[model samples]
Structure formats: C-alpha cells, structure tokens
Target: MEQELKAHLKKLMASGDVAGIIALKSERGMAKPYLFADASELECLCLTPKYPMASVARLLLDEDGAARFAIVCRGCDERALRELAKRHQVDLDRLVIVGIPCDEEMARECACPEPFPSVVAVGTKLEQWEAEDIGAAYRAMELDEKLAFWKHQLEKCNKCYGCRNACPMCFCKDCELENALWVKHGRLPPEFPIYHMIRAFHLAGKCIACGECQRACPSDIPLMVLNTLLREDMEELFGYVSGTGADAENPLYTKEEMQ
Candidate 1:
C-alpha cells in the first residue's frame, strides 16, 4: 500500500498538478510531515503515525496563497480539511487531495465511524466501523455521578495544552483556554470543569471525532467521552455532523427567522 501511494504521489508531482505533495516521511524511525517537491523524496514517504496533515496543509497554504499542493489524506483528514475550508481557514480550490482509505484494523484502532475517504487513490476501502459508544457508562450515570466522574478525571490534568495543540480544528490565534478570564494562568487543573467545559462548548458543533485530543492527553482523561456526547447532541438537535462536507450548513451558525 505504501509503494502504491508513493507511486501515485510521484505521478502527481511529475504531472505538475501541484507545487508539491504534502505527506509523511519516515526519518530516524519517526514519521513526520514532509513536502515531496522532487520525486526522489517519495522513497522516504510513509503512511503510519497518522499526524494531522490537514493542519500542516493549512499552514503551507497560508504561507503561499498561490502555491497548489496535494495532500495525502485519510477519511478524518479529508473531513478536517473540508471543515477548515468551510471556516475560511483553507481554500479547497488550491488543494488536490490524494485519498487513502483505512483498512479495518486501522479503523477499529481509531474507533473511526467513517474510515474511507470519498475517493480511494490507494488501498481498499472498508465498510464504516461501528465504534462502540465509549461514553455509554458515563451517560447512564446520574447528574452527580457524572460530575464526580469528570472531577476525578479532570483533576489529573496538568494544563499541558496537548489537546488544543493537537486539534486540527483549533486554529484560533487567541484561544479562550488561555484567556485569564476563563482559565487562570499558572493554576493546576484550571479550576476544574471550567477549562474543559469551555473547550467542549467551543467544539460543540465542530469536533470531527478524530480522537487526536484523547491521544494527545497525557492524563488520559477520556476527552472523547465529552466530545462524543456533544457530537451526538449536535446531530440529534440540529442534524449537523461536523466535517462531513464543506457545503453542509452548520445549524449553530445559521440565522433563524424570527417567529
């Protein structure tokens, strides 16, 4: 699969369809985002350690508005790019997405709901994985139980901000999490659920369930539990699924007629 993807990317670069191809390159046993400007660099290209390539693509595009680039994207990466485009963070017109479908094992590991991109340039597409509702037990608890649960989990947070840094959707220059009014600086745990609740509300209709937050959290504070619950509520109340497409109207941002 890696070879096939590398060949496809080499073709894209050779065809001059893009200025460069943004994908992961294996170096020192670590996979990091690298731009393949020359076909020779394709030899080092890899497809593991799913970094948030969407964010890297956005950064490159922002640096050079006229430069066109091709991105190696999984289902979540494509969705993240679509959402970013909708928010004016990226221009899809300047992007040529090289879609790579995730296998069943990768899908199950990530607990991915939709594991295949719209177009499969390489790798076989798998059926949507029905990720178990990890928040089931938490949801079943009473209000007090839920409160205690979060309190215990949140107390372990050391304010590393890894979750924010890893999130593809968190592109704000000035994050509310750092605002002294909400989360005081130099305070451990950031005054309990205040810090997390603020972030949860901010991502109410925007989190794409990429699981980067949970993966980045050092405290292992089931961040996805809160995010997944909010995602469900957003769908149930507004019929809006984040990162599904760029054209879908977000109900939270849409104006309603006054009755």
Candidate 2:
C-alpha cells in the first residue's frame, strides 16, 4: 500500500497536476504532519497509528499552499476534509484525495463508518458503523449523571488545547475560547464543563467525527461522544450529514452566512 501510494504521488507530482502534496511524514520518533513538494520526501511519508495527516490537511488547505494539492486521507480525515470544503474553507476542486483504508485497529479506535474516502485512488473500502446508539446512550443518562459524567471527564483537562488545535475545522484566528469575554483569561483547567460546552456548541453541526480531538488529548477525554451526540442532533434536525455531498451546507453556518 505504501509503495502504491508513493507511486501515485510521484505520478501526480510528475504530471504537474498538483504543485505539491500534503501527507504524513515521520520526524524523530513521532509522526508529524508536513507538506511534501519534492518527490524525494515521499520516502519519509507513512500511514500509521497516528493521524497527524488530518491536521496537515487543515493547515495546508487553510494556508492555500497550492492551487492543487493532494491529501492521503483515511475515512475520518476524508470526512473532515469534505466537511471543511463544504464550509467554503477548503476548495474541493483544488484538492485531490488519495484514499487510504483504515486498518481494523484504526476503525475500532474511531468507530468510523466509511473507513475510506467516498472517492478512492487506492486501498479497499470499509464499512462505517452507525453511532446513533452511542449518542442515544449518552442522551439517555439522567441529568445528574450527565453532569457528573462531564465533570469527571473534564477534570482530566490540562487545558492543553490539544483538542482545539488538533481539530481540522477549528480554524478561527480569534477563537472564543481564548477571548476574555467567553472563556475568561488566566484560568487553568479551564471552566470545567463550560469550556467543553463552549467547544461543543461551537462544533455543534460542524464536527465531522474524525476522533482527532480524542486521540490528541494526552488525558484521553472521550470528546468524540459529545461531538457525535451533537452531530446526531444536527442530522435529525436539519437533515444534514457533514461531508456527504460537495455543496451540502450546515444549517447553523448557512443561517450565519445569510445574516
């Protein structure tokens, strides 16, 4: 698979279809995200347990690195990129997707459905699991239980902003989380559930369930549950599914766009 991906990327770069390609590269012992313009760097590229690729995609697309760029995306990353593209932050036509199917471990880790891109350049497709029941289970909890659950969950927060920083969709230069008005400056451990609640509300309909936030947290917060619940609600209320179609828009942002 790695050989196939490298060959495909080499072909794309050689053909002058894309100025560069954004993919995961290994630096030191840890896997980090980077943009590969020279084909020689493809030797450093890898698909691994780490999902630093999505973060790279976000950075590359947001920065507008090239008019045409290719991303080596798995299921979650593919959905995230599509969602970003739909929000008008990423140009779908400017991006070329090279789908990489997730292994069993990756699929189980994210509970991902459609563990490959809707469009594929390489790799086999995997079925995506429905997270409806997971969302319902969270919603079914008692109010006190929910409160306690979140409290205990957020207590592990080191206020690292790993979740926000890792999220492909959180591209705001003036973030509400940092502003004194909403998040209050000079506070450690944040404001408990409020910090998370603010994040959840901000991501309400925009989160693409990539699980990067959960994965990035050193404390391993189950942030995906909150994201999944809100996503379920957004789907139910607006008949919206993030990244399902090229032009489909999230109603929350669409309302704001109209205003």
Candidate 3:
C-alpha cells in the first residue's frame, strides 16, 4: 500500500499538478509530515503514525497563498481539511487531495465510523466500522449521577491545555478558554464544568470526532464521550454533520447570519 501510494504521489508530482506533496516521511525510526517536491524523496514516504496533516496544510497555506500542494489524507484528515476550508482557514482550490483508505484496525483504534475519504487513490476501501457509542453509559446515568461522573473526571484536569492544542478545529486566535472572565487564570480544574461545557457548546456543530482531544489529555478524561454525545445531538437537532463538506451551512445560524 505504501509503495502504491508513493507511486501515485510521484506521478502527481511529475504531472506538475502541485508545487509539492504533503505526506509522512520516515527518517530513522520516526515518521513526520514532510513536503516532497522531488520524486527521489518518495522512497522515504510512509503512511503510519498519523499527524494532523490538515493543521500543517493550513500553516503552509497561510505562509504562501499562491502555493499549491497535494495532501495524502485519511478520512479524518480530509474531513478536517473541509472544515478548515469552510472556516476560510484554507483555500481548497489550491489543494489536490490524495485519499488513502484506513484499514479496519486503524478504524477500531480511533473508533471512527467512516474510515475512507470520498475518493481512494490507493489501498482497498474497507467497509465503515460500527463505532461503539462511548457516551452510552453516561447518557444512561441519572442527572445527579451524571454530575458526579463529570466531577470525578474533570477534577483530574491540571489545566495543561493539551486537548485544546491538539484539536485541529481549535484555531481561534482569541480563545474563550483563555479568557479570565470565563475560565479564571491560575486556577486548577478550571471552575467545575465551565471550561469543558464552553468547549462542548462551541464544538456542537463543528467537531469532526478525530479523538485527538481525548488522546492528548494526560488526565485520561474521556472527552470523546461528551463530544460524541453532542455530535449526535447536533445531527438530530439541526441535521448537520460537521466536516462532511465545505459548502454546507452550519445549522446553528440562520442563512442571513451566515452572509
């Protein structure tokens, strides 16, 4: 699969469709995102150890508006890119996506439902996995029980901001989390459910369910449970599934407001 993807990327570069190709390059034993402009460098290209390629792409695009690139994207990566484009953080017209389908094992690891992008350039597309609803138990709990659960989970927070830093969707320059009026500086655990509730409300129609927040949290807080529950509620209430496409209007606002 790696070889096939490498070959496809080389062809794309050779065709002069993009200035470079953004994909993971293996150096020694580490894999990181690298822009491959020369076909010779394709030999070092790898597909493991997923980094936030969408975030990297946004940075590159911001640095050079005229530059065009092709990105090797998994399902989540593509979705993130679409979300960024919708928010005017990226110009999708300047991008050529090279889609790669995720295997079942990778799907299970991330608890991802759709493991493949819109188009597959390499690797066989696998069937979508039935992701376990991680919020089931929490949703089943009574009102007081739910409060107790959140208190226990949120109390472990050390105000590390790992979850915020790792989230691809958290690109606001003036973040509500950092505002002293809301979260209060120099305070641990962040004022009960205030910090987390604000975050969840903000992400109601925007979270792509990449699981980066939960993975980055050192406190082992099951952040995805809250995110997943909100995601479902957004879909049910507004008929909006975030990151699916760039053109879809956010149902949280009116058409006039969007303009």
Candidate 4:
C-alpha cells in the first residue's frame, strides 16, 4: 500500500496538484511523521503504528511555505479534519487524503470498528466499528477503586503536557488547564483526576478518538478510552460526531444550534 500510495502521491505532485506530502517514516526506534517533498522522498514514506497524522497536516498548513499538502490518514484523522474544516481551521479542498485501511489486529488494538479512512489509496474496506461501552467497565468500578487507579496512573506522569500539546483538535488559544485557578502552578502529578477529568470534559464532543492523547502520555494511561466514551455519549445525546460533516456543530457551546 505504501508503494501504491507513493505512486499516487507522485502522480499528484507530477501534476503540480500539491506542494508537499505529509506522511510517516520509520526512523531510529519508531515511526515518525515527516513531510516528503521530492518524488525520491517517497521511499521514506512508511506506514505503521504511529497515527493521528491530522496534527501534522495542521502543522504543514500553518507553515507559510506550504500552499497545498496531502496526508496519509486513518479514519480517526480523516474525521478530525472533517470537524476542523467546519471550524475553518483547515481548507480540505486544498488538501489531499491518502486513505489507509486498518487490519483486524490494529482494529482490535484500538477497539475500533471504523478503522480505515473513508477515503484512501488502497486496502479492503471493513464494516464500521460500533462505539462500544468500554467506559461501563470503568464506571462499574468503585469510586475508591477509580481514585486509586487514577492516583497510581497519575503518579507516573512526567508533567510533559505532551497529551495536550499533541492533540490536533485542542487549539484553544487560552487553555484552561494552564490557568492557576483550575490547576495550581508548579504542581507535579497535577492533583490527580481533576487535571485529567478537566481535559476529558473539554474534549467531550470534540475528541475524534485519534488516540494521540494516550500515545502522548508518557505514563501510558488509557486516556483515550475515557475521552472516546464521553465522545460517544455526546454523539448519542446530542447527535453530534466530532468529525463528521463540515458544518457539524458541537452542542455544548452551540446551545442555540441545539434548539
């Protein structure tokens, strides 16, 4: 699929359709995201474990040097951009999507049914994954159990802020997490579930389940599960999926839109 995608990208570039292609490359110990400009750079375009290429797409768009760009996307990333486009944060018409399908193993790892992008280069399309009640298990646990679980988990936090920083949909100019009132300054471990819950609540309707938050967590908390579960509730109760349509408004802030 990488070769096929490379060929497609090469064709697009040959036609001067895009200025650059943002994809992943296997380097050092892990797969890292990179932008490939010349055709020769496609050899480095590897597809693998790392994902949520939407943030990289946003980064490329922010660069004044990048006029048009293409990104290899999974279902989650594609959905993220769909929502972002509605906010006028992205110009989808000027961007290209190279779809990559998810295999059974990958889908199981993510507990994802809709693993592949709706649009992509090559692969067998599978049935959309239903959003499961993963949180029921979490919710079933006793409050003390949940608190202890999070306490242990939060102890492992390095205070890197990578989870917040790596999110594509988290574009607040004034992030509440940083406010001294909400989260005290210079506090390590950050006062447990408050920090985590605050972030999760903020992402209630907007999180695209990209799993970047979990990947970014040096502590390896299953943060995506909580956020994704809340996202499901938002979808069910409000009829809003974060990255579905260009104009799909989140009901939380748009009380008028809800009416």
Best by lDDT: 1
* Clashing pairs in model 2, backbone N/Cα/C closer than 3 A: 113-128, 113-129, 114-128
Q: What is the TM-score of each candidate against the true structure?
A: 0.96, 0.89, 0.95, 0.88
Which tens-of-lDDT digit does each residue in 124-156 have in candidate 3?
888646887777888899999999999999999
Scored against the true structure, residue 133 in model 2 reaches a CA lDDT of: 46
Clashes of 3: 0
Name the best candidate (by TM-score). 1
| Local distance difference test scores for all models | 0.88, 0.79, 0.88, 0.79
* Model 4, residue 245: C-alpha shift (Å): 2.1
| RMSD values, in order shown | 1.4, 2.8, 2.1, 2.4
Clashing pairs in 1: none
Q: Can you write out model 1's per-residue Cα lDDT over 1-259, one digit (the tens) per residue? A: 9999888888888899899999999999998899889999899999988788899998999999698999999998998999899899999999999999888887777777688789989988875467777778887999998898889999999999999999999999999999999899999877988999998988988888888999999999899889989989888887889988668866778897422
How far residue 227's Cα lies from its native spot in candidate 2, in Å, is 0.6
Instruction: Rank the candidate models, highest TM-score first.
Output: 1, 3, 2, 4
Candidate 3 has what TM-score?
A: 0.95
lDDT of 2 by residue, 81-189 (tens): 7777766667768778888877667676777655677767877655545433456677889999999988988888888999999888898888888877767677777
Superposed Cα deviation of residue 235, candidate 1 (Å) = 0.5
Candidate with more favorable, higher lDDT: 1 or 3: 1
> lDDT, candidate 2, residue 112?
69
Query: Which prediction has more favorable TM-score, 2 or 3?
Result: 3
Which 10 consecutive residues of model 2 have the lowest summed lDDT?
125-134
How does model 4 score by TM-score?
0.88
